[model samples]
Target: MTRIKNILSVIPLFLIAVLQAQEVEFGEISKEELLEEKYELDPDAEAAVLYRSQNTYLQSSGGGARLITEVHERIKLYSKNGFGHATETIHLYKGKSARETVGKIKAFTYNLVNDKVVKSELDKDQIFENEYSYSYDQVKFTMPNVKEGSVIEFMYRINSPFIWNIDEFRFQRDIPIKRLEAELRTPEGFNFKQTHKGFIFFTPSTEKKMDNRLGMDVVVTRFDLKDIPALKAESYVDNIDNYRSGALFELVSVDIPGTVYKSYSQSWGDVAKTIGSSSDYKNELDKTRSFKNELDPLLQGKTNQLEILKLLFKYVKEQITWNGVDGKSFQNGIKTTLKEKKGNVADINLLLVAMLRYAGIKANPVILSTKDNAIPLFPTLDRLNYVIAHATINGKDYYMDATEEFSDVNLLPIRDYNWGGLLVDNPNKVWKHIGRIAPKKADNMHLLKVVVGADGTIEGSYQSRLTHHSAYQFRERYKEKEEDEFLNDLERKLSNIEISGYEVKNAAGYEGNVTESFTYEMENGADIINDKIYFYPLAFLRKEENPFKLEKREYPIDYGFPFQDRYMVEITLPEGYVVESLPKNIVMNLPDNLGKYKYVIRHMGNKIQLSTIFDINSEIISAVNYLDLKEYYNQVIIKGLEQVVLAKAANGRDTGSTGNK
Candidate 1:
């Protein structure tokens, strides 16, 4: 009986192998897949990757060697939400002289109709190309005749003249993947260093074989993985791509006979030296004559270094507007940028550095990856995408980005709040870290005065003050909005209350705080049941839902900044009513002072005063503390739901018992 059981298990395994081999081939759709309504492992999944494979190798000729990557992917759509998977986008890199090209594209969508498979071929004319940036382009296409329960497959080849530029091979995505296979082949003349990231790790099977076509030995690395769960997105994550599972190949060295040896991978110091010596970077900074005429006049009578720094900073900000492009090197030279009065991030910030140096202030360029871009896993020049200016004033470093008009010294745009940046001082030839030691802060204060009538109508005057990041965000949102439109939206958000006398102060200024005041009237704001009234003290300001809902999280919670929110409210009870119940005063704090919450209430004659403060001190909470954080939010929600009760008094005297609810 035991032998029979073992043989039965082997038979199932062998059958599964046969089925996988037969069903996963390109351009072939099995009946079982087309008829399947949902994925077995994740029934609610919108789509699933049926199969994915990639082959990367080098092609050498008398002229030179080029890299070629062949990719094939098959996906199944289970519902309308999965229809987005039918559209695919491929990003290509453009070089100064040559660019990567995609060709030999083929795709088809298969649908089950009347128990038969119908295939629709993709039209080549439907494919379109778009310029994404100065260095990148996108090739996009949608599958023809796609619908629910349809399987789509596509195959393409990318040819690159730059052999060292090997893009990362991703094995995980936002949707579940059943099987993934990848192979990389390289000749003996080149060496590569590979790095893997994310929670899932794959050990590639490596081997060596002689290539008869090239008459050389090649190293082949193969990776095969099955059943990879999707990387679920969660709230408060800085960048989802930072936690993706993938492998990146960086060319380490090239050693060929009768040719000089070249090394591509180097330490941070070496990378800094290479950047400093580059003609496009250091040479551009040295060309101070381009802006000498304007900058010299701006700093003519400015003797103090600090004053000169501020003058130059303001001059660049007001002079050149950002063209909404992010780059590390100049797209238009400094001379043209000044002439056009607009340029990319590098153009504006580098010009600031140049002018500061011309004014005899210690300044340098700080290279960093924006929050949208993934954090740099290794020290490669390609990892840095954005640049800002760093200055030393009174023995303290101040980071500044002229692209943001409302930003102040040391208060960079939130996009620049990634891990850390590298300070590139060309003359000194030194590279050091610009740490993110201070957390960005925002403060909000809300004051409400409420009057409850015998008819159960609630009227109140609402005023709020915002500072720091909060003020910046408010200005960015409402700066372009019409007053009537802004009030309409606010009314909808504040529980459809009727609002009037709305006024906002300091909305157009970069200094001080933003203040907003409005009077409101809300119906059904409280429950009335014959001589008794019940209402929440916070009114529309209460937090109804908890943002942290995941049972378990793999990524850290990135709030981007630490913040404090406070509310002070005074409610005037209806005439001839006495307080029957009040919410208990409570205080809650997270471990190690990471966060705090406090609530207090006082019954002062006919007026009830309430105040609450909620503050989070740390910007990032690790995954290990996720449960604690989730529970903390749950408690806050519970407290906000507590109600205040009032009862009719007798003879204008206290008649109802007052106690904590």
Candidate 2:
């Protein structure tokens, strides 16, 4: 972000030294890399990628040519933490009819012995493959004799049946890459579109060559980068993948002589039309006309559209359990989902839309990619990874996803609240865009009535309300654990303080707010010296440390959604006690009206009243405001940890307790 280091010029010098330093073949050990003490690029890196290359081409197999990629990488470990480099895990996408397969993997870890280099070859028996999900598997292997100062190298080839979907490449990782290269060679028939992302920019060299075997001229694209800094993960980004330097290649079209000029890439409108017309999708909703026998009984002739929407949402969410897999299309259709009471995201959400249509409410399915998945860079069907339902209620489009049990109407999982959703109709087979809904006053509010005892123990009645994302988070955990277990966890977070009178409101419903009230008795939570007492008013709710540790940030700060938090405390004092010291009321804000923070402290009657508000009005902050945001949270943290002091009347001398509780 500051200046591009002239790594291109510097790398050639190393390239010259590397040429004669030692052998740098696939199996040959490079003594210079193994004995390397510190990586000049990043001295703190536990490991470094010495050299890595991915060469992809179309190869003939099974009477046709398929996409095949050969990958080779060499790594040098600086410490034990780098041992993970020796273990390789390749994710293979295997469906019912198509798959990506790995071929001929050779791995070796080299180390210096008493007089010569020792090689520990990888055993084929050590390689194991297992299904990670319904449509994905991982082939895992760990090299032998991996340790500190070891140079590990491995090479493998992968052949994918889906030729149009080329593998994306990353130029950066968590560790520095001393030298990185990726080359792609394809026949002239294919026209591919390449897109790049991240703060770093790169250009690839291209050349053409004739292939006699294929009888076509092939284009070779080579990307070479040096001293590529590691992409460290920071707080507040939607996904680190969004900021990592990478490239994506998608086939746009293929025009072979004597063959048809087929288009491999389609517009989003076409993708929506194609999906809406699919038998597995549009037809799924059309078949629900037969569900009237079951739907009529539940609706009971209720004509209220809002009530019907709630009933349908509750029925689908409560009756059918999510299979925990999200997808764009239904696997078993809506009928099977209703009968079996279990299905994937598409099945459950589609069923909701069908029942809604049967009830005379106009509804459709909206497909979008989740936050954790790749950012949808282009208009392609492959970019869509999830589906939810949208309905017009009183001239307003309300989005809903029943995959989550507690998800209410118009409330979706945080992951589903990404960029935007594509609204597609089944009956009409048309598509439109649905904008994202913003959250308002979704604060984690805390109100506490506390009194410090003479024996240094603090007692309080704690009440808190969690709204929006905070509510969903707490309700999710509450559902996962039993009552006592949940209480224990809450106490553990509050420093093992005893909590009673605990009551949870709206735990079973999705609307309004989640209310949690409890009485707490905390020992050693206050300090007493002679006639003075000092304690933190927040109890265990204080933020112990700042979340932003980086001096500078290069990516946007994403809070997923805008949020607010307020803590109001009313600490009652003893009969003769008076306020000895109180934190000064302070306000901190971001420039240009981005965000603001306020800490107001005052004494009301016989109690010290404190009100603190931290609001992030914007959903996201660009990298330019990162340092300001970081400092804002730091001030909030400091104020959250500030202490409140009280002194007994009698000889009202200025004596105070020192040291933190």
Candidate 3:
């Protein structure tokens, strides 16, 4: 009986082994994986990560230590959406006093053909490097013979001279990561601090192994993460990288017995003090005598802090042009930039700080990470990317970054609106938020009127009013693009319409409402069948698409700023016609009065007027409110598509009956 029972269990065990064969393995492309058409776990994914590995540690060289991180990845492309681009790129950072570089790389592409594996190795000549600036460079290589059902793999190592530059290991990406492993080993003289972001939880396997590197006793730490899902991006969010699943290891302190002891990753106050003490920043603050002469003429005997501040701010903005880099330390002194009139972000903004101090407005330099850059999650002077001036007017702090030519005083360029900034004060240091004051509002208003003829052809007029952030965007677009190009875009968008002409108000100013008016004619925007005509009441003023498509969202839905969009349209009926069907008007409201939507349709003697008011009074909505926001917009889109139907009277002629639609 016992032998029989053992034999029964053997059959089940055999089936388990066969099922596990579908799992991933590095450098081993099974026929099942190559033949597979889709990943059952995520049907929408075009490509998937089979495996990823990272091993970062300190390698001793010539009596000094350099940080080395080795990396390997295996990816499978399932469709053309994933196969079009298969280039591998690595970013290398270099500093004045420290250096970092990438080592030789090995990569290959594999495809299954006629039940056999075919291999294509990446050529040595295909590798190229691009140096972005004096501080950074990138190396790139494209995989060879990549196609759908291809398995591509690459491995490389990077060496860095700065210990604090230890990078974070991201477990999640645009595609799912099946298995990710990372290991770190350092000498006893080094210590580190770790941070974890995103929703996934990973329990690391820890073990101590004896090793000797850099002429010192070292212990290795290993971490292995498994089955991390993809962190997909969604609309209405700022820098999804801020909330991705990852682990960061930063060097906290270095203690070399009887030789040197240095500390990093300190308290916020210490971080500010270190920045204030740097000669690059401290010296720029002290040199007020140099720019005082230039400010005297611009100041014009102004006594109010706000007046002096505006004069100096306007002077720097008009006189200098940014070289399109974000930094806190100047490459050249402010005095030189004032004369040369062309400088990087630091050179342009630091001069503003110097001038403000000369005028005795009690201004200081504050560093901010733009929306494109990673949010500064910790108090470290090294990671801050951009600098702006901070002033106290009537005991209120106003932060300004003049890197953008279209910037208007406290109404900063949109990118500078990241959450927090580090304020560098001599003895008293603090973290300043991007908005200590109330947040700004967004306004976009449109008025459209059209008249439909007997045969369903239409003539129309459109006028738009923009304010605040909306005004800034309009001013920027008209300044950048040609007038003909802008009007051509409108003609193409309005669907079966010809733009007769248009005019713009405040084409070159920052401080007022921008107005735009245009005239047009529509060919088939309204449909006519026999003696009946049909049209959506709003015409071109309707919302085109639903911005929120994801069934589920992981982050807060941020509109960036509070906004209100108002659209109104009036449609005049053709001769001898009356409304037969009209969509029921609807009203929707978000909880807590965060948002409201209203649609109204009124039938006048000869015209039908429709108006929709959609407004959100706050900049951000919590995840708990996402479902509501998604449903609200979906209803708006549905209502915007509702049609207005008209029927001809007994005396009317069927002119459109013979015309082809």
User: TM-scores across all candidates?
Assistant: 0.92, 0.90, 0.88
lDDT of all predictions, in order shown? 0.82, 0.78, 0.74
Query: Candidate 3 local accuracy as lDDT?
Result: 0.74
Per-residue lDDT of model 1, residues 1-661, tens digit only: 0001121121111100001132357877899989888888888899999999888876643445567888899999999999999999998888677788899999999998899899999999999999887778899999999998999999999887666667888888989999998888876666789999888978999887766655556778888999888887888999988888889887777676766776666776666666667775678898888666777677778799877877787888889999988888898978999999999999999998988888888899988888897687777777778889999978987788899887666767888888787788988768766666364678899999999877788999999999877888888878778888888998988888999999999988766789999999988888999879988888888887888887888888988888999999999889888888888999888877888889888788788888989888888888888888888888888998999888888785854333333
Error of 2 at 570 (Å): 0.5
Per-residue CA lDDT of candidate 3, range 1-661, in tens? Answer: 0001121221111100001122334467677768777777887788888788887775545644566787888887889898743777787877766557887688889999888988898888989988865457889898999888898888888987774466777778877777777777655555667778777887665444444222345545566666677777888887788778887766676665764566654776666666777896766677777765777776767899987887778888889988886777887778788788978888888888888888888788877777777766776655667778878889977666676766667777777777667687653455343432234787889999889888878888999998877788878888888988887876777775788768999868676688999898887778988779998888876777888888778777767678898888888888788777778878899998999999988777677778789999887788778889988989998998899888876665442311101
Error of 1 at 207 (Å): 1.6
Q: Can you give the lDDT of residue 652 in candidate 1?
A: 50
Where does candidate 1 stray beyond 4 Å? Answer: 1-23, 254-263, 437-439, 655-661
Model 3 scores worst on lDDT over the 10 consecutive residues at 11-20
| Higher-lDDT candidate of 2 and 3 | 2
lDDT of 2 by residue, 1-661 (tens): 0111221121111100001122246876656777887788688788999988887776655554566788889989999988887788998876567778998899998898874688898999999999776557899999899888898899998987675567687788878898887888866766779899877889998877766655457778888888888888877778888788988887777676776676757666776777777776756678875687888888886989988998889888888999888787787787777789998888888888888988899998898988887677877676677889889988987788998977877667878877776778866757765566554446788898888776788898988899887788778999999999889988998888999889999988777799999999988878888879888877777777777888778888878767788888887776677677788888888987788888887776567777878788877788899888888888888887788877787675433332221
Best by TM-score: 1
Residue 303 lDDT (model 1):
91
RMSD per model, one decimal: 8.3, 7.2, 10.3
The true-versus-predicted C-alpha distance at residue 441 of model 2, in Å, is 4.9
Evaluate model 2: give its lDDT. Answer: 0.78
